[model samples]
Target chain A: MKRRLPLIVVLVTAIVCMALKFLNLGERGTTLATDLDTIVQTSYLFAFLFGPIHLIRLHYSNVQKRRVNWAYSAFLVGVCAVCTVVFFINRIEGPVSTFIIDSITNATDSAIYAMLGFYVCSAAYRSFKLKNVEATILLIAAVILMLGQAPIGDAIIPNTSKFAQWILDVPNSAGMRGIRIGASIGAFAASIRVILGLERSWTGSGS
Target chain B: MDWKKLQWIDVRILYVIIVVCLLIPMFHPVGLPVAISDNTRLVYNTVESVPDGGVIWVSHDTGPGNAPELNPMIAALARQAFRKNCKIISTSLFNQTFGPVTTFEIIDEVAREMGKEYGVDWVHLGYRDNAWPATIRLMIENIIEGAINRDWKGEPLDQMPLMKQVKSIKDDVDLIFCTTVGSPGYADWMTYVSEPLHIPLTGGASLTMYSGVQPYIRSGQLKGFLGGLRGAAEYEQLVGVAGAGLAGMDAQSLGHMTVILFLVLGNIGYFAAKRAGKNQ
Candidate 1:
């Protein structure tokens, strides 16, 4: 019953959602769009629950077995409980709710981003190389683009300013555009296949 | 995977060169002249030709995760929209937590600097989940039914003069701008909204995903595209505004240049050692 219910929901939702696009219905079609958003919003609300669930399940198992991180069980549950309380109380209309939202936003935005710089630098250090001809060209192009992009490129290389501009527009754009067009064609083909139910990647209930 | 046996690239060398390239630009912005491409030119001209009071659907499809890169384009794009005296119908489908808030903050700040009004000139439809289908649906529906309780000053979409004229997504929207993390974004817009209806769509997306979105641009599915921070930098340049994109470009450029120099040096080192051994 549980499996059947979700599948029925998915199939029904997908059909209705997909059908709306094909309808001759003029202005009324927007009502379906509003309904679609509500579906997405509900999905997101459920996602907020997973963060706590994972933390609790992991720690609960650990504590029951007296594992190394067992003590974290209490900590995880306690924090989740407190946050849940605050979340429910704030209601987007409450000042406390605003505080909780702001706190999450700040940490996710600034703190997370601040740490990403180091990771990006580390990744660049370990991986960036000219292993072959294309790599060499890319490296050279990188220099041109980088220098040309920055204020210093014009100073160091006399004509780099205009040169960089040409590179981004012509060669880089051409290469990038080729790949993008290819991908889009592929996606369009796939979407058509899906609409026809030729693509069943999202199908399968037996497994 | 032997942890200690792994060869480590010299981190300090990379840092030194990156720092030097950045420092030089601070003192001498090298005046690297910028040239607008036909595509970028199209983006520029499209905005330039927009009739005054035209309504633009500006979808700030980026989160704070990509705000550093995409926000500059939004700022510049907003500047152009405002300068053209167009009414911007700004909204977001991504950044459920941050999408609406950040986009609004940016538009609000830009509008304030430009002396634009809130409802009369622009209206924020705010964050809507299920962005792809929702956006498509909204475009089909026209009236924003999602933002129910909130208002410009505790008012509704009907009360707002700015939104009154826009009955559906297609009614008054002159152009569609979808700035996002990658293909899912531009692709979604192309498939659901622009391509099917023949609506002109443009994009600003992550650099890594730029190539991936090129086909849509080539196929005329996308009118113009801003690829990564550099694209944003160019937009800022066109707007006569200097911000994070230009600054980041300085850093990104130097990093690229330094990596190239190291490649040449490494290749020389490899070849020299190879040739010396061959002779011996």
Candidate 2:
């Protein structure tokens, strides 16, 4: 009954949601859908509770075990606790919360993100090679695109910008569209399988 | 062939060089001439074409990491919309706790510059967690219910005069612009709001995600799109204001140059090493 009840609930919810989306029940229908959405949204918020609980449990276990770099885990727990308490006591816009989010959190995140430029430089130096024709074409196209994005590209070769645009609008777009179509079809099939109960991997077992 | 030397350039040296290239340009910018593409112009014109006293919904679907490339576009849009005297309804589907702070910081800066009044001319509906397309769907049905009781400031929505005219997303807004970095973003807006509600939607995306957004723009699902930092710079240029978007272009240019240089040197070493082996 445990597994069967959950599966039934999932099947019914999916079917009802799909039906609600497709049907036009007039103002009453819209009201019902809105109510359903509110319930779903509230449920989502409840689900968000699991995230922090899981985080604390994992980090606490690591700290208890004195795992390698357990000090970092301890730090993570400390930061999480401080932030959560500050947020609860003073709300998200409080001075402490603001400072933590904007200065400490945002600054660190941006700095980490900025390091990508350096990594790209290093990665290109270490890994990019001209082993074959395709590699050469890729290398040239990448350079052209890089140049095309910058004004210096125009200064170097005025028409390289146009060539880059053609590359993106034509070949890149074509390839992307092909991938998107296949992915969309796959998603559609997956959705159908889920609705019909054929895809039960969510049960943590392969079908 | 001394290509062997090229094969083993210390990665730290490359990192130092890239940092120098990026930093030098920032302090003393190259002031490289920026070209405004047709798509960027389309984004500008779409925002500009909103009638005086119109209301527009701006969905911020990105956060701090994307601030460098995506934030400028938000600031630019806010500036343009404010200049046109458009009422702004700002919301986010991410950063449920701190996203409103980011949204307000951008919009408030623009509002101060334009002397626009909050709760009178603009209001932030704040961040809605987990409920995305549903949030959008409900907003189209009833904005007040969807946004809860207050703006991000905790002011009651009933008292906010700016929301008086906005009863539903379908009826109240002139256009929708989503500054997006990933999914539950442009796609969600297109699916839940634009297509069903028949509202015009535009997307501003980071450079990395521009390709995914292109097909939507091409298919007319999105009215237009802002392509990364360059697009933001172009939008700033159109409005005759210079901001971070324009300022960062120089550093971006130098960084790209550094990457290309490394690629070229790397390849040269590869081919030369192959030839030296053949000769031996």
DockQ of candidate 2 is: 0.68
Per-residue lDDT, model 1, residue B265, is 54
Of all native A–B interface contacts, model 1 reproduces a fraction of 0.34
Pairs that collide in candidate 1 are A30-B141, A146-B253, A151-B29, A151-B30, A180-B214, A180-B215, A181-B215, B142-B168
Q: Tell me how candidate 2 scores on lDDT.
A: 0.82
Among all candidates shown, the one with the greatest DockQ:
2
Q: Model 1 - which docking category?
A: acceptable
Candidate 2 segments whose C-alpha is farther than 4 A from its true place: A67-69
Clashing pairs in 2: none
Per-residue lDDT over B1-280 for candidate 1, one digit per residue giving the tens place of the 0 to 100 score: 3222122546566566666876786776644545454556667777776678787888887776788889888888888889888889877777665667778888999999999999888888766545356545554555555455344234577877887777776556777888978534777877777776667888688776665665566667788788777778777888888877776776666656665565555555555655566879
Q: Best by TM-score, which number?
A: 2
For this target, which candidate reaches the highest lDDT against the unseen true structure? Answer: 2
Mind giving the per-residue lDDT tens digits that candidate 1 earns over A1-207? 754555566667667767776676565766665667767766766876786688788877877788886677767777778777877776654677656556766556866864665456656445445568886676667667666555556667777857866676567668776776798799988766655555555666322
Residue B44 displacement (Å), model 2: 1.1
Supply DockQ values for each candidate. Answer: 0.35, 0.68
